[model samples]
Target: MHLIELSIAKFEENLCRLKASETVCSSSFSSISQKLTRLQDLHECVENFLLLPLTQQALAQECGDKWINELLDGSLRLLDVCGIIKDALLQTKECTHELQSIMRRRRGGDMSFISEVRKYLTSRKDVKKAMNNALKVRESNCTDKNHETPAVVNMLKELDAVTIAVFESLLSFIAGSKSKSSSWAFVSKLVQPKRIACKGEEVANTNELEKVDAALQSLVSHKSKKSDNTIQVEDVQIWLQDLEANIQDIEEGLECLLRRLIKTRVSLLNIFSH
Candidate 1:
């Protein structure tokens, strides 16, 4: 039990650090990916803690009417969120590959290029819509009924809260920013002479994806010269390729993490079902 308590404390500390380091508004693709990895680590610890004999005995002893119901519900919601996110990533990846192909085979002012950009943007809008729907699942599920539960149950509840928080940030990053000004700023920066100087920092900032998003938007919406449009298309293609690679890595991580989440949920069910 003492060891279980220590493990839970360490998990909470890691969760606090993750929250402090990245936020929904400012997180970059890479940072959010790192957060996903950290979340997996935390869940692994949770699985081990749950497997302990003493921990199982304690959980079995509890009446666990409200607390258990909330946890089981929260687990179901987490699974739902994970599946949606994975599908979104796959959808975005397909759109990205299509856009990259369009950019590769075509040059300036091609009607197909413009068409593909519209499709990609539309896909992004759909993805964000789905993510927002999933996020409505309620963090309150993790916080309610905590005060009256055992220490182990409280720890599990806090873990659920932090897990949901991480997923929320991940979903937000994938969905991109909703603010018009923020999106416009990325577009504006893309055409600037100094944008080349800041290329190194793009991966570390939320604007990495936004840069490609804005560049494509600018290409289609602006009446720039053919040569300028070609250059922008090339830049956008490179960025899209990079994003596709990152998305693949993140998708792999999410799949692994999803399995861990399922395993943890199953463990909980087993403890009380008997």
Candidate 2:
């Protein structure tokens, strides 16, 4: 194999290495730290390959070889991976903050948090619509040349499914929150705002109240188990925390899938380099 082919092979190896790093780091408590270190290593590996002397000569060749062009294309794709990793890092941090905010607000007795949750839930429709449109466009744009097509399609599908699930969880959390929120107003004869004024809120809160007894049977695994007399703020807090955690996890998986797609495409370009 020529110097160019050898370099392309090295690039493919790094692609595999990047995926392997994710698998290794996923099982650990320090996943965030491990991911960052692995990502930095990936950046260095690709950067070094791109800056090699022979690789430069190959790109600068007078003959305009097809292999050289493929190498350039693959390298460009790797640069796109760089942008992806950077954005993923920012998103991971954002998700963490969002998760903590949910926990903090619940402890501080923030009712407005429910309003925010509802707003985001409503926005899910727009998000799904936009994602559907993007998926259609991506499917139409797929060509045999793009080796990342399968992974891209899988990523989009998983994202759509996860988004729907998260939306439903948020709705459930809102319902649970209302139940706990309304437990204080005890005058059953008087029309409660949540119990009667708002149809959606009424069902969510009332239904939750009805299930409080049954729910306790399953709460033995939790740290604090409360009796059926009260709707425990901790119950709502746990529900919200679970929903937030799901969103954070989905974001991470999507980000990783994207990086994998980019890497697969880079490797394909290398194979086609010959």
Candidate 3:
């Protein structure tokens, strides 16, 4: 039997098993059975087309074209599934934020409520896996090598942007609201000053370092003058550290992307040159 026919048979068998289960209601089982029957009808239609003579080249081509279209539709559906998973992750982040707000408002600071939210966060592993699997399916569908299509490249870039946006939004939300100092404090450590090279030579200007220090000091002095309730000096230091670290990471990622783009452009030029 053809692959579609086999799949239809398996679906029908599963539907039968589901219907036989004592736990399932009659109405639900009937609905599923009807859907399976429709799928079986589709399978029969495809089987009829396949049974036609090889001399009917146009009909064979039409069947092949329809099959390819169905494959593309399935792949697009996988992409939509990934989007749904991403939205679910965002909802989880929102729930975490709301829980944090509730904790802050409550006098006793209920630990159990926060714990429940953390548990929900932990349950996101399956959703993450589903998203990754969908991404893999989408990537596998793009087999063209000679011509680089905008759709393929844009899809990848959009996926990357969504991921980065989600992470950054979650981090910012947690940092701003959560009272659990450990979480934000750990992130602060990630933002610590590291030796970075701008040009070929190492930065040796004591004056430039002094200028940066002076600017930070001036900002602190201004804030202290303006507001009676200012953030703690330690917190300010940590925030600055984290900001620097994030800037470094962004710069590195940009450089890597630029290099890849340049390489692809060079390859394309060589292809045209030939």
Candidate 4:
């Protein structure tokens, strides 16, 4: 269980950094690399010892079995966090790369241009609403001081901060390009220019062109239905909502199981003293 617990703690620390900063740097990924190493080691350690008969019997003990259940439940919640954070990281990384590419491109219509700033502003508001809804859910289930702050809430805050930074940078870039003739488009066009057919329709290289088109179609056919480029802001907001609900359930399980473990430990102490 320490494997899961410590990994979660490390993840929380990274999320704290994200919540406090407007940008993610290479430093964040450096820390993540160390975390992945630790997780891999822990997983190997668990597998090496988990199936022993003595270990199985100890896990079956009724006096403290609730702790085991809580640990498993917590691991599931942490996996949910892992999935969401991975998604956010990949999205932010791609967005950062594309924005930089556009920034460095020669000032012309051939590179790329973003949509209006107002649309970005609306998307930011929608993200804020999602963050608020997550908080509302936490407050609804939390009954006492002990249940107030779950790891999920802090994690969601990081997600909110990262998302806001993404849109804010986009808005700034689009705003600055307003006065340029080359950046006059409403929607963006990628750096890859459209293909143009040969003029005059000569048949000298017809076979080679057909072969190239066949190769290109073969490459394009392998693309999946769910590409990152196709995901919407609304899709991310929905994912966050699902993550928040999972956190709520995990927190309840942790509290209940922790109370049981403490009670069992106290009872054992009493029996030994008598």
Best by TM-score: 1
Query: Model 2, 125: alpha-carbon shift in Å?
Result: 4.5
TM-score per prediction, in order, is 0.90, 0.37, 0.29, 0.32
Off by over 4 Å in 1: 23-25, 137-139, 142-147, 201-203, 223-231
The alpha-carbon lDDT assigned to residue 248 of candidate 3 equals: 41
Instruction: Give the C-alpha miss distance for residue 106 in model 1, angstroms.
Output: 1.7
- The alpha-carbon lDDT assigned to residue 13 of candidate 3 equals 56
Better of 1 and 4 by lDDT: 1
lDDT of each: 0.78, 0.39, 0.35, 0.32
* Per-residue error (Å), model 3, residue 4: 35
Candidate 1 or 3, higher lDDT? Answer: 1
Per-residue alpha-carbon lDDT of candidate 3 for residues 50-146, written as tens digits (9 for 90 to 100): 3334312322333344433433343344334434543543544444345445445542224554354344344434444444544444432333322
Residue 185, model 3, lDDT: 36
lDDT of 1: 0.78
RMSD to the true structure for each prediction, in A, is 2.5, 13.7, 22.2, 18.5
lDDT by residue for model 1 over 195-267, one digit each (tens)? 6568566535654666667677777776345553233666777789888998899999999999999998999
Ranking by lDDT: 1, 2, 3, 4
Worst 10 residues of 4 by lDDT: 184-193
Clashing pairs in 4: none
For model 4 the TM-score comes to 0.32
